[model samples]
Target: MLHIVACIKQVPDTKIIKMNPKTNTMDRASAPAILNPYDAHAVEEAVRIKKRYGGIVSVLTMGPPPAVKAIKKCIEIGADEGYMISDRRFAGADTLATSYALTKALDKIQKIKPVDLILCGKMTIDGDTGQVGPGIARRLDIPPLTSVKKVEAVNQEEGHIIVHRKIEDGYEVIQSSLPCLLSVEKEINEVPYSSFPNMVKAARYEPHIWSVDELEDVNIKQLGLKGSPTIVAKVWAPPKPEGGKIFEGTPKDQVDQILSVILEKNELFQAKGGY
Candidate 1:
């Protein structure tokens, strides 16, 4: 059976998010969280592939225990199993740190069932950096394909997958070897409705959680903020422009006054150029 693994993330719903005036960081507790919208499409595509190819679908996520909500979402989407890697050591991770942690989890997953394919959303809304997918492929020494819009075929024996990748203006058809990672565009697939049984399973699902100790050759220094090369040096919201003072007048008087001001400002039209 084909083993398709999709990586998903839990993110703060930024629509209503408030920012700290002093620190300029999101007030996470004030905002409700949701499964990343882009990852939803990726999960749907993976489930679709699993249904057609007759394989088990698994999901992997590296986040806090609260992030298990995203894993359950995958269960509702038809994944057979969900794995979550969570540790306090993984806090304050940037793309690089996050990639390291996720790669460690990927290594763990590979030990059980050699993953045939790996899928990810185009990018996370919060981070907006799509580096993790390619980073995983590089770490695993496999091909990484990005912005994929369609999956043409997958041949297990040949160990290759054919796909259409989003390009500058259109798309490019490309082929890559199996055990490949793909970052997919939102147009890849439509999310299907959850059946009663799957919904029930999703509601009760408890994901397999792994800590730093379980992964192989994991460098503790590289797992979270400590391992990250990039740091958020500082963040501040743009100062809101002071509200403009509106001159109140009738339409005709307002128009006349506006034109008079403009004419007076122009030296050529003003009677006296100075004063």
Candidate 2:
């Protein structure tokens, strides 16, 4: 049976998240944590592929203990198994260090079960760089098919898969070899509501959690903050746009008011020789 692994992450709900005025950083505690939306689609696509081709789907993540919640959420989406690597050493990792750490975990997973294909979301909500997926593929020396919007076919026998990759104006069809990695677009599939049985399984599920030590041949210097070279100099919220004047009157009066405002601006411009 084919073994497909999907990479996922738990991120704070960005829409509801707030920024700390003092620190000028994200206030993670202000919002609830949830599965990354793009990664959810990746997991859903993996499940669909399994249902179509008759294989096992596994999900992997690198995060803290609370990330187990994200793994369980994947289970509810129909993933067969989940794995997580969590530790303080992995804290404050940028994309480079993160991909390095995850690549190590993936190596372990590949040894346990030969993975036919690897799947990932286009980007994470927290870090929208969309670099980790391609970075992992590069480290593994495999082809990275990014912006995948549709999985046309998975010809396991032929050891190749066909997919539609999104482009600027339209999408293009491409065929890639097996063991390749895909960074899928959100439009790839619509994730449905979780089934009752899946929900039950998710509630009772406990994923395989590993620390940095559990991974084999890990380079200590390349694990976390020590490995990260990129530095965030500063962060601040954008100034809110000035509010427009409200015209409280009938349609004719509102139109007249707008015309008057336009004429006033035009006169000001003319005064400044802006004919």
Which pairs clash in model 1? none
Poorest lDDT segment (10 consecutive residues) of candidate 1? 266-275
Tell how far residue 138 is off in model 1, in angstroms. 0.8
Residue 181 alpha-carbon offset, candidate 1, angstroms: 0.5
Tell me the TM-score of each prediction against the true structure.
0.86, 0.90
Write model 2 residue lDDT over 1-275, tens digit each, in one string: 78999999999999999889989998999999999999999999999999999999999999989999999999999999999999999999999999999999999999989999999999999889999999999999999999999999999999999999999999999999999999999999999999999999999999988898899999989979999998676667689899989997899999999999999999999999994
Residue 256, model 2: lDDT of: 99
Runs in model 2 lying further than 4 Å from the true structure: 245-275
- Candidate 2 residue 211 C-alpha distance from true site, Å: 1.2
Alpha carbon lDDT at 253, candidate 2: 97
Q: Which candidate achieves the best TM-score against the true structure?
A: 2
What Cα-based lDDT does every candidate model obtain? 0.87, 0.95
- Model 1 segments beyond 4 Å from truth? 236-275
